[model samples]
Target chain A: MLVVSLIAFVMFRFVGDPVDQMVGLETTLEERAKLREQLGLNDPLPVQFWNFVSKAAQGDLGISYQFKRPVAVLLSERLPATLELSFVSALFALLAGIPMGVYTALRRESFLSKLFLTVSLIGISLPTFLIGILLIFIFSVNLQWLPSFGRGQVVDLGWWTTGFLTVSGLKALILPSITLGLFQMTLIMRLVRSEMLEVLRTDYIKFARARGLKDRAIHFGHALKNTLIPVITITGLQLGSIIAFAIITETVFQWPGMGLLFLQAVQNVDIPIMSAYLLLIAFLFVAINLIVDLLYVVVDPRIRIGGAEA
Target chain B: MSDALLSVRDLVVEFPTRKGILTAVDSVSFDIGRGEVLGVVGESGAGKSMTGSAIIGLIEPPGHIAGGSIELAGERIDNLPLEAMRKVRGKRIGMVFQDPLTSLNPLYTIAEQLIETIRTHLKLSERDARERAIGLLDEVGIPAASRRIDDYPHQFSGGMRQRVVIALALCAEPELVIADEPTTALDVSVQSQIIDVLKNMCAEHGSSVMLITHDMGVIAEAADRVAVMYAGRLAEIGPVRDVIQDARHPYTKGLMGSIPTLMHDSDRLTQIPGSMPRLTDIPPGCAFSPRCPKAFDRCFSVQPACERHEDREVACLLYDEGGRP
Candidate 1:
């Protein structure tokens, strides 16, 4: 957490002087000194870092210069939106990707396998932003299937077709989620297929066949379990990238999320708000990676790395 | 007894390589009776392993049975579909592989894998399967079977893992077992322990075994009959005592001579002169002639026919004596 916080501080610090950001280069030296003194830029580096750290620990991330409010308030308000987008996209990716990968790996020479591999290759190779735009064009302008901009209002249940929590909301989320999930899904699928192929090459698979195990039992039962180590590691690394990608995805879709808030802070130069938000996202990514690493050890006990111990 | 419990007749297996079709097992044949062990011995690529794989219907891709008939207990098994083969496989035909280290799935606990094997083959409930697994584990000499069954493959030593594999194979009490180098991947002492377990277990269960290995010592100790493969063909098949005491094929004699024996102490170790040819370069007339010390003009020029004695078969010119053309 400290390292992550330092990253936020250093990222802002290296981007150049906060006083220059605040007072501008055209100001007189006396005026700049007055502004620097007012902004507390005269404080030592260690004191500034400590001040931010202590306040952040207390859940009071100081105040944003541009937004003129506590950084925590903006983050809390937008947290749900970012989470919702990430959840939706991750659901699409896992739901489609794992099975598609398993299928391609199992049926390597078949036409279905070839088709899936080709599609996954294409999905993995292209940029997510390009795919996102293509999807927006197709669904919004060309097809006119749903609203192109803006969002559905959050309301109570019974509005099945057209409320924030209803089919309209679901439809609204679908395009952006799929566009965001495409590359990740493809990447995961490719990872699974390759790992599954490696697992199949092991001697146990040959033994399974000699034992007269059914194809499903042999493929899913014997082969799949062994391949899980690499698959799970890939899943952990990809999940970190997922959180990062969700930020960009939310920005592109103009969703009312932490990502949008971060973008606004970046544009308006809301130092505390942007820095705090970035550190929080980094914290989430680290937490997620830790969770996945532990989950892998739980699933397959054989995996033991540099162990502070699970 | 039962006209042989498992009979492999004129088995021919071939694989299509990039260059051409290379025959792996050519006109090789053998059988195992109830409560019998037939050891198939040869150097690597002699098709001993391929024949074992083919009999179990586990011939991998690009390699397949070209011509053969496999009869298990009077029923033709060559045409059985994959589902039927599966039903036969853990249920009626068990297999123990060479590598004890990798034979069991490392992720799942031994109990889980064993229970799955038991339940899939037998019409047993989960509780029954669990009980049966413990029983099988205990039978294989795994101490504290109940507690240790939950441990993953890594937790067990190599011998213990191999024992676990044996227990898995015996879970269904199949009619026949194809133990392909069952003790190959164990320490020297552990090898003897495992071989002893297999011998005693099969004796009690009335399960025949087709044991494949190149170690003459294992064959001498465990097998009632021995089949020797040279290149892709069976060079000799006979009762163990006869084959070892009076091996008919020059290749078999070379192999027997090659075994470190106190009785036949040569100045240097008696080795077959040449290396076994690659499958693609197998000679037309006789694959072993180039290496055999007793090779004559007839041996090099024409393929020797497989001839049968009372309970032995030999495919060599020496066996025919004056009968060769």
Candidate 2:
């Protein structure tokens, strides 16, 4: 977290000052000095960093220059939007990707399997921004089936708010989620297929067959369970990337999420918001990796024993 | 012949390689009668394991039973559909592979694996299956069978794990058990214990066994009848004592000659000159002709057929009626 914060600090520090972004070019020099002094921008770099760190540790991320609100408040309001999108998209990716991969691996020589492989290749190769635009063109402009952009009206339930249950909201979510999830789906599918192939060739699988186990039991029960160890690791890592790096999809769809907020903050030179976003993303990656490690103990007994020994 | 429990006739298993077809088991024929133990002994790469795999329909892809038939209790099973073959495999014909580590699934408990097989082949309640699993475990000489039944494969020692595997194979009370080098991966001290357990369990259950191994001592101690293989072909087969005392085929003689004996003090053990021929480069006539010390002109020109001698079957020109040279 410190390294990430320092990197973000150094990057934004080298860029032109936020004062120039906040005020007009014709502003008087005295007014500029007054504003710089008020914001503690006149302090030395080390003092400035120390101030930022102390404020961040206390959950006071300062005010966003662009939004004119506390960075913490803006993040809390937008966090649910990003979480909802990520949860739905990740659920879709895993539900569809793993089974498709298993089917393809089993029927590797079939034409349908070949087609799925080709489609997954294209999904991984194409950029998410292009996929978003293409989806909007087909579903919004050409077919008039779904909304083109913007997160639809949300229903606040005190603890959590979601656009997913509403009709217009669900329609609005389809294109952007698909655009965001395409790469993850393809990544998961390819990983599952390769892992399943290797697991199917293992000695235990062969012995399972010799034991006269039903093909379904051997494939899904034995082989798929073994394959899931690696797949879960990849899925957890990808989930972090999906939530942190949905910038392009969020921008194209005008989704009210952290990615869009971060983009607008960068444009308006909102250093506090950008730095907070960087630190949050780094924290998220570390947390997700820790979760993946714990999940290994649940899925595999051998790993559980090893962990117990440690 | 009618009482034979498992009869494998002219079994030919082949692998389609980049360089034409490689016949791994070349027209190998053998039988195990009711409550009989047939030991198949050969050097490495002599297709001993392939023959066992073929009988159970577990030969891996690109390697298949190209020709021949396997009959279990007079019903042909070689050409059965995959589903039907599966029914026959664990229920009628059990298999114990060489490596105990590989044979058992590491994640599941011994009881789970055992009960699954027992319930699948036998119509028993889960409770009944659990009882049967424990019973089989106890029968296989596993100490504290009830408690150890719930333990995972990794928790057991190597010999104990192999015993668990033996219990698993006999869970359904299969009529025929194909044990392919079951003791190969064990310590020398544990090898005889496992073999003794296997022999006693099979005898108690009255199941015919086809024991595939390269260990001559195991065959002499455990098998009633013995089959010797050379380059995928059966060289000689007879009562274990007769074959050990007076091996008819030259390859069998070479095998017997190589066993070090305490009865005779020999500075060096007798060994066959050359190794078994690879499938791709097997000579047109006898596969053992190049290695046989008594190779004659006819042995190089004509492939000898397995013919009955005084008391055993021998596949060599010397055993032929008029062609003896």
Give every candidate's TM-score on chain A.
0.85, 0.94
Model 1 regions lying over 4 Å from their true place: A14-35, A155-164, A303-310, B264-266
Model 1 B-chain TM = 0.96
Stretch of 10 with least lDDT, candidate 2 chain A? A7-16
Candidate 1 local Cα displacement, residue A150, angstroms: 3.7
Model 1's C-alpha root-mean-square deviation from the true structure amounts to 3.2
| Candidate 2 clash pair list | none
Docking class of 1: medium
How accurate locally is residue A135 in candidate 2, as Cα lDDT from 0 to 100?
93
Put down candidate 2 lDDT per residue, A1-310, tens digits, no spaces: 8888788777657677878877888999999999999989888999988887788778888777776789998888888888888888888889889988999999999998999899999999998999999999998999999998887878888767789778888878888888888899989999999999998888778877777778888888788988999999999999999999888889999998999999998887788789888888888899999999999889878777766778
| CA displacement after TM-score superposition, residue B86 of candidate 1 (Å) | 1.0
Give the Å shift of residue B299 in candidate 2. Answer: 0.6
Query: Candidates' lDDT values, in order?
Result: 0.82, 0.89
TM-score of chain B of 2: 0.98
Residue A296 in candidate 1, Cα distance off native in Å: 1.4
Tens-digit lDDT track of model 1 for B1-325: 3579998888999999899999999887777888899999999999998998887788888888999888999887777987788788878888899998988887778988888888788889999999999988898899999999998888889999999988888888998988999888889988888988998888888899888988889999999999999889989999999999988788888888777778765787778887999999887677888988887778777777677976898998877869455
On a 0 to 100 scale, what is the lDDT of residue B264 in model 1?
A: 66
